[model samples]
Target: LCLALQDRLEKVEKEVQSLKGENLALKLVLEEKKTFASVVKDGEVEVDSWKVVAASATKCTLKRHSAVDLNNRFSTLSDEIRDCGQTRVMSTVIKTVLLLAPAYVYLYINAVYSLKSSHLHYREPLTDLVSQMQETSTAVQNSTNGGHPSTSVYRALEIDHTKASHSLWSEDAQCSKFLVNFGKNIEGTLLLSFPRSGNTWTRYLLEGATGIFTSSVFNDPSLTKAGFLGEVSSLSHNNTIVTKYHFLQKNHHATDPCILLIRNPIRAIASLWAFKIVTSWDVKHVAVIDNSRYNTSEFRNFYQNMLNRWMDVIRNALENSRLRLLPMYYEQLREDPIKEVRRMLNFLRLKPNEERLVCVARHITGKMKGGQKKFNPYTKNEMNQAQEAVKIVNNLLVKRGLPPLPDYSKYEN
Candidate 1:
């Protein structure tokens, strides 16, 4: 028992030495931790932090970042987010433009095509309509015959005078007439005639033959009541067979064809004075008055003034008119009414109907003609002045390749 006790004491001493060595090691480790903490507070030591990166379910790695490195990483992450947002917005804008591109392109192409077609439609000549109608009729006839066209071709017929019918203009003796609306498809002609140049009578003949209304610049109630339905219509409306205008000074740019009716100044002035005196100064009177009643010295100064005016109107028209001109004489119209009417219609691009023309021939002298002949109201000097004016107009007409006026000294119409 003594020996066993001794052995146990030795073992206890060995264990106490081992414990002292362990305590010394632990104190060294604590001192090292305190020194490191103090160094950190003094900014002499840098600290590193680790992040775990999982490669797989069973595998992992550590990633370390310092404070400065962490801030750089966050800044890089924020920049990536901002860039992604900007890229998404730009992509959306590109997609939207792409979606609308086809529609904008289609609209631009369609507008260009429509503008070109409209120009072509308006610029086409009005005379082409007749050929187009004929072609359409021929095509339809051929189609109806099942590609075996007729041997007899369709053709437009000339005016046949043998065909007889009642008047298409009026049913009564008052020259009251029916008129078709002059549609937009037909272009207009200008009837330029000076005052008292048988313009009213010519309008009567035109309406009788064509059954189309003639428009006047002045809206005279008397003439309107006497079948001038388009008297009040505007000239720019362009819906009449002929529009009467005495003054073309402001309308020098008119492209319409003109029918300039000329009359002997002596007779025209005499007839105008008689008509004005009879109708109380209404210049648009449609009535034929007694010329012998007003043939006196009162016509001397008026005749000179009217002769100058007559020359001025003719000179202005010949100088300023830009389109085709058909110069007509009232005496010629009085002599051959049917021929003159047909000539006028042809110039207007209208096909004359024979039945209506026959009616015009039958009523050549209208109700306005009475039982009296016109008297000469001009003096010998006035007559000489009228001849000189005619000579000047005739020279101008010859220069323009138009026919000259007849000898007015012997005119008896």
Candidate 2:
């Protein structure tokens, strides 16, 4: 009994020592937390104090104090703060760009629009000034010719056929008083002819009589300089009265009215050859056919091919087209200017004053008249070929109830 009592006293003393050590640690923890005079129990210590837990069935552990790990927590918190700051900066940059982008685009477009408007505003007055200058020059020139006040004055007076007798006979047609069909709501007439068939000379007469410009698919600088202003105009026929077209297949006016101007194939071929020789075959040159090249194998071959082409064009026009055709013979036009001009005007639905008709008669023989060949340029065999082509083409014309071509004796002896 005494030994058991002594053992109990030693155990009580060890527990008292443990309790005293824990009490010191509790005071230290309270001091760190800045707590004054904090009460500690026998078994419990202050917050985050290093201590051991009592366990009977499992292992007990001594845990580290919360305050002791302050350095590690501070390092982790600094990294999180840096990441959050970077994220906020990036978000601000993206939002600023998105908000400003549309404003920048709008400013750029507005600047361009303002510049274009300013340019057009400045350009309009300069155009008007140029046009006024041209009109004034034309008026001054008309005053010098035949005591006419102005071109417009004479034209307006001539349009009123009742007062045309009182109107001054002004030769302004030679000065290319013809107007282009720009913005005019009129369909065009196709003036179809083969090469070297007096197409240019006919155009000069036509424009003089009608006071309207003619156009061509070809941009002939020669004709343009000769006052055919619509030479380089649009091929759509929206800007010209009559368009000269050589190829029948290339005719855009399939259903439109056509004026088929026929000339002797032999004369046309001979004239074309002379033209090629004089102008070096450049279509842009205006050349009168003189006795330049003749009676060669080259001429013979060219005649054969061109004669076939001439026959083919005539055949195609008569066979394929259902449009109203006003066939004009080149020979008949050369014979009488007044009669042919009146007939042509009737066909084209135009009424010209007698004063303009007199002016057209005065300017009948244009500057482009080819030099007359006194003798037949073709050889015996070539003449036969040309005669055969003419016979065939004339028969085709007569069968279609069209006028037969006049005698082709201009090129013949």
Candidate 3:
């Protein structure tokens, strides 16, 4: 660019020099045409030293004073004009040099943008490369965890939690059979809820929100293959499980954080009766009721059993400092599920942005949602007794710095 401007400047200088030469030639011609002409016209002899005729057909004439010196002033002005032209050009060049960085930057940006526009067809390849990088990362993780069979039932989604060094299954041979050592272990989070108190619904909610499967610590035949500590516990420390009971370890084992899902005691007892008596799911109660001290009436038996279980679990959690227990209410879950689930996620130290739809619809109860023949069958006296039992438990819980149980008398028959 500088070279081009230099050439242009040279051309301008040549034109200026040519104009100066023409002016000089005209001065010489006027000097050569100077004639002394005396005219006796006014009584005194007045003289004109030079008169120059025009060279063009327009009849323009030039008059020159013989004594007036104009060359010095005219030449000085011509030289200043030449000097001004050179100064202006030099100023422009200096400014251009100072702004070169910005000029280069502008050109570079345009060039890059043009190239990108022309190569728009390569977008798919770039996308594919990003996908491949992600797939490679996932493959590396799977390999680090010991490769599972392609037909492996292990899930793709997982809850990330800190793992405790201890195991739930002690040295028992039966429990030891489930221990598998395929990969790194993580201490799992415990999803605890009183049975028949939205436990199943909470499990489903966690699964749908996190895309991770919750395993049962119970050796339920359905989840037998779903153990987490490889073969021993269905809950692998690498994942979180929603279990009904804390495993009966010798001195209580340290594991992941626990979330307790509970409901108003009255409703919970009613649901327990439905599970044990009406549905006969509590086989221990159903199978050995005749041989035990439990009341002959299943409602009374379930109420007493579940209440004791509730107090035991809550008291245990309260006493154990290592147990990080987050208590969630079933009524709150049923009323505004999203808010409760978000609270649970925050408790687990997990991001609630995982999924907004908890998929609790499957476990939602309707007006007629009872175990076999169910209704508001408890009398006011029975309801009052149940309320009092819950109050005693709540009083103790409050003294222990835990939350009180809600009154569920409204749910009584």
Candidate 4:
């Protein structure tokens, strides 16, 4: 019975092993099928995604190409339109010019022939007409002289000096008569002259002489004043009694003293020219006043005109006994400043302050700290021009009953 039991046990073990092996094989087969199915599904999804990406990329490329073509067409259209408009404008301008060509030619010919005939014949009426024409042309040339409104030629011609009489004295002569009254009130006052002259320098000297005053008193604290005249006018009207104005103008109070300061015309012209350069002036439509047709020659003529104007002013001032104009030479101021200052103080009826006189000398010499070097306007060429101008001025001065300028030959060297 034991032998039979052992045999049965061994058979049972073999059956269990066989069953285990079968189960393992089935599990392996199922796993292999699952892996294969998963791989196939993933590959299908990838292929579909790639196809979609390709279709979308192609569509975007086509859209971009269409946009580029549209832009090119628009640009081409714009260029064509611009070209057409330009061509039309050019055609119109050409037609207009052609139509007016004959009229312009006729006018130019008439003007030239008339001018030539007037010059050739000594006909008084024709000469007068020519003069009027010349004046008109000059007015046109200097239309933008001061950047002011252009004065018409017709208006200029119509401006008859006889009809537009300038009164010697106006009803508001109270202000105009200031210098006359000044001589009575102030013991002695210096009458400074020059249209953009070194009136500021004269004021500085006056301030230095007073020593009790500041530079701020002499210099324009607010740049509202046009010039020394304007400043004085304001002060006189405002009743500011600190210091008096050096420069004189029309409509001054009758009670003010007058001390006239004069500079060499050529030097004054050069100084003005330099000032104009640093501060640009209106130069459009400059009149060609030069006899030589060169720019330098024209500048020389302009300088002469300025000198002539200055001479006229000087003569008028000197002749006016009521104004009590005391002429002071710029050269004298430079050479013997202290002596001149004292002389000026005496003329103004003020006692000479020696300390103040010293300060004036120092200020003018630019010896003070932070003082600027004086601007010298004369050059070699300018010196030559000045000599020529002075000769003419000397002749005018003699004619106007004034002494001629001292020989400036010593200064030329």
TM per prediction: 0.55, 0.54, 0.45, 0.38
Candidate 1's TM-score reads: 0.55
Task: Please give, for residues 234-299, the per-residue lDDT of candidate 1 as tens digits.
Answer: 557665568887667745745666888998877777766666567442343544555565566666
lDDT of 2 by residue, 1-413 (tens): 23533453344334433553552111122112222113223322333222221111122221332332422332333233223332142232222222332222122112222332322221233223222222323323322111112233222212322211111124454434433223244457778888878787777777667765678988787766656776776547454557888877744456776778888887787777777677443442345444546757787788888898998877777776545677788888887666676556645655443445556666567655555555567778887888898899889878877778888775342
Report every candidate's CA lDDT. Answer: 0.53, 0.53, 0.41, 0.37
Instruction: Point out where model 2 deviates above 4 Å.
Output: 1-183, 250-252, 280-292, 410-413
lDDT of 4 by residue, 1-413 (tens): 23433453344334433542541111112122233223233112233432233233221111112333433433433233223332142232222222332222122122223332322221222223223322323333322211223343321001212211111112333222211111111232334455444444555455445322212124442321312222323333322112444333443433444555667776565555544444222221111122222236555666767766666555545444433334466656655565565444434434434333433453454211111223443457766766666676567556544445666444321
* lDDT against true structure, model 1: 0.53
Which residue pairs clash in candidate 1?
Answer: none
Candidate 2 residue 266 Cα shift, in angstroms, is: 1.0
In model 4, how large is the Cα lDDT of residue 110? 25
| Better candidate number, 3 or 4, judged by lDDT | 3
Instruction: State the displacement of the C-alpha of residue 284, model 4, in Å, after optimal TM-score superposition.
Output: 21
In terms of lDDT, model 2 sits at 0.53
